[model samples]
Target: MPSNTDISKLKELYESLDRLKESGEDVVAEIRKEINNIELQYLKENLFPEMMKTLSRKISWLRCSVDMNLQFNGEKQLDYSFCKSGSTVFIRDKYECNCPNEDILEESEMDSNNLEIITSTSNQTDAHDTPKRSKTYTLRVEFPNGKVFQGNVVSDTYVAVIKEINPEKVDSVGLSHAGVAVVSQTLDSKYAKYQKPIGGGWYVMTNSSTKAKGFDLKTISDELELELKISLVPLNNSEEAIPIMGISESERHRIRVTFLDGRTICPMKVLEALVEVVKYAGVDRVRELGINCCADNLILKNPAPRYKKLCKPVGNGWLCNTCSDTITKFNQITEISQKLNLGIKVELV
Candidate 1:
């Protein structure tokens, strides 16, 4: 999950470090430190969360199923099963009294057979029930250049809306949620909540009803023609903003920034535009402007210790606080452009 680029960079670093070690260079320590950083980033970004999700799903399946015969440690054929006590699950012998046992088995104690049973059972259940849960919804895809495609899409419990839009292009594009580009492989139900059975099937994709911001299609593949702003309207009627297509006016309007070099970035949110501006006019230059970068609970640069949790790197060793309202983000961009003397025009289209 560390991406091909990360893997290539790590391989190069390791080879360089080995050569440096043979040459008796002190730079070996720096390369080793960088390798450690990449490993830590992989664990943080991919490994840990994936492990947790897998564990959680297994536990949930076990809790829902009745009388699971799982062997512990591969030595004892214990007729153990899980029982729910409020929110916590406790293990108990299948033949024993209905009381929950105090002792709980760790994941390490469960043998490969036990894990296999759980995984297979979960998959079987999903495969069996998916067809019954399938429903049709209105799919309206609007591109950055103002091209729109309106159609109907049938979705199962597992299939995402992006996949339903264009199965071949799903890998090339992703949907945006909370200003973050959510992978196309993620379950649609995870982001868009099913409101009712209106207009074939209605689902809302906005901050109020859902975490979905809009379609964040990327031109990562040659098959994808357009790269800029794309919006997927989930409703049959665009004017009525309830039950389906519940995006606010701000979420609907795309922010466009024109730089001095005749390069322009349009159909992005305020925060995204601000991040691009910072990337264009380096972090050091923005700080030198002596303008207050902090807005709402966000500290754009030079964040205090308390705000560190809310900050993410925005190039050049600078952190941008992500905790801010939409309106505050717009104001901050305006202030940043005015103070930097960049004469960059920020417009909402």
Candidate 2:
């Protein structure tokens, strides 16, 4: 409210919405949308654009670790095979890194043989304050075709300056890395094994180009066979997340999570929250979970009797089966009235 709106009015609005929600009124979304509109108006409606700008900045550059292999000062040309190798297998690419490297390193086609690794004092800094010429980093990335690619997030400059580029790789997902069970490799490993997971796993990247190759929405969709589109949903911008916790149900891909507090959330946001929860407890904890939610009450009643279906009455009630059954219970009721105790009939007509 920016300390501008009247406090009493704001409190009244909040309480009214809470009451409506508690009473099982299905107007929460509409009410929340209105509230967002009000806040957006208060912000001069720049919230959407500003949020986009912030998200763009965060995705612009990502940082991570990488592996590097470089042989200094060798043959004029470089030749190498980029393929999966070792207990820790990494994907390969035809053309390697696009990051800037030393200027002396010459560029050539991927098939060129008799290559040399170029090193320059300016390209690297040594322990003794001396410049040495070796720089390399293995970046993590996934191709559009769902193949993971990991190599030096090096620049053209670095590749051109280095030589003796014959390279081979080993597979990490298979026994090449370790003949360990899935449980041991996943849960017992030093770190989460990105390889051999259903969904793509996390990867390391040292430079911008490498970071670009890491798991992204496209990579996920390709690996998981699910379509994904980055979207900006208009969530409540209030500093407080609406406190809600509930059982979630998914029937025909329509999921609903109803909190004990009676707040119902759509599956999308519920799934988002679940991601955070899973991260906190680890995947194993989440796999062992089941959710419960409140069910709606149902009341059953017999069909009403028609006048044409009624038979002649035996006493004070009609003889139709439905009508007679209803009258019999009351007619046979014990008399709490003093008149009935005196043998005066208290009739229910």
Candidate 3:
């Protein structure tokens, strides 16, 4: 049942066991320790979803058709081996299960408090194991329909599949960005029938195949290639920002707050409302504003009447389109956050 990555580690562990035995070490005890070490590592990170699936065992069951392969070199990829098998997979299912398993592990309050909300992936690769540079990069993709997607990339080779959203597929996803082309429609597509905003949708990008860091995605297709040229935009609300077409005001700039105490607030507030959050809810108690939980407030940065640096008929008494005067606004926010000792982040969805 081991994956390729797991088999590799198991082989290394066997070699270590042999070496330890030859050195007059207690082979049985030493191997036990070695196996325990491996278990500890897997406990730290489950590259496979086995544990997660098991936790949801009573919810629903599915299976994965896995293909295993090994190759020594590219030139002689002919020198390869492979195996295929069917595996029963238990994953989270949409059908609400009122039956709760006492043994089911839920994220603890402590864990929720420490949970990171905003995580960025990168797409750069280094072949020679060069020293890693602490480089942070932002990714922005603006659709011709005035829809903008923004995020940070922390990995050099993190690739996202750019799929043109289809209306027929719209009734099949909860995230609004799912039901992609490269992937098969999920079982929950039926659940999407109840979703609102029926019609043509924006082109969306979701995680795709990854081979190496710094891989050229253009090789995939013309559509995939164009995704790499996404323009960068300021994350904070800008004075002259263009409203992303199709997305609602509540959907675009709204803030969703989640606290460490297992509480959540989906108040449709906005840009300056972050200050009040810190004032009311102290700094450390606020777990997150954007990631995981619903956003805390709505900046209403999009759905502009017309795209402009200082667009007309601006709401909130200001243009939400320009990149101008960001420093001052950020300063004001920073001052408020610092004064209240809050570690709040203002994110635009």
Best by TM-score: 1
Q: Candidate 1: misplaced stretches above 4 Å?
A: 1-242, 246-251, 288-312
As a whole number from 0 to 100, the lDDT of residue 284 in candidate 1 is 76
Q: Judge candidate 2 at residue 219 and give its lDDT.
A: 33
Choose 1 or 2, whichever is better by lDDT: 1
Clashing pairs in 1: none
RMSD of each: 18.7, 32.2, 23.4
Output the better candidate (1/3) by TM-score.
1
Clashes of each: 0, 35, 35
Evaluate residue 333 in candidate 1 and report its C-alpha lDDT on the 0 to 100 scale. 66
Write candidate 1's Cα lDDT for 1-349 as tens digits.
4555665577688789867887655758789888999867766865577667996777775533222223233233434443322322334453433333222112222322265676687666554465454222343344555655444442221134344344334322323334322332222544445321212232322332221223232222112544333333344443432222233343344457898888998743355676787777777776666544333223354654333434567786776664454344445566678877788877644
Ten residues in a row with the worst lDDT in model 1? 100-109
- Give the candidate order by descending TM-score: 1, 3, 2
Alpha-carbon TM-score of each model against the true structure: 0.29, 0.16, 0.19
- Worst 10-residue lDDT window, candidate 3: 290-299
Q: Model 2, range 31-110, lDDT digits (tens) per residue?
A: 66666565545344333455568956875564422222222122343222211112123222233444443321222111
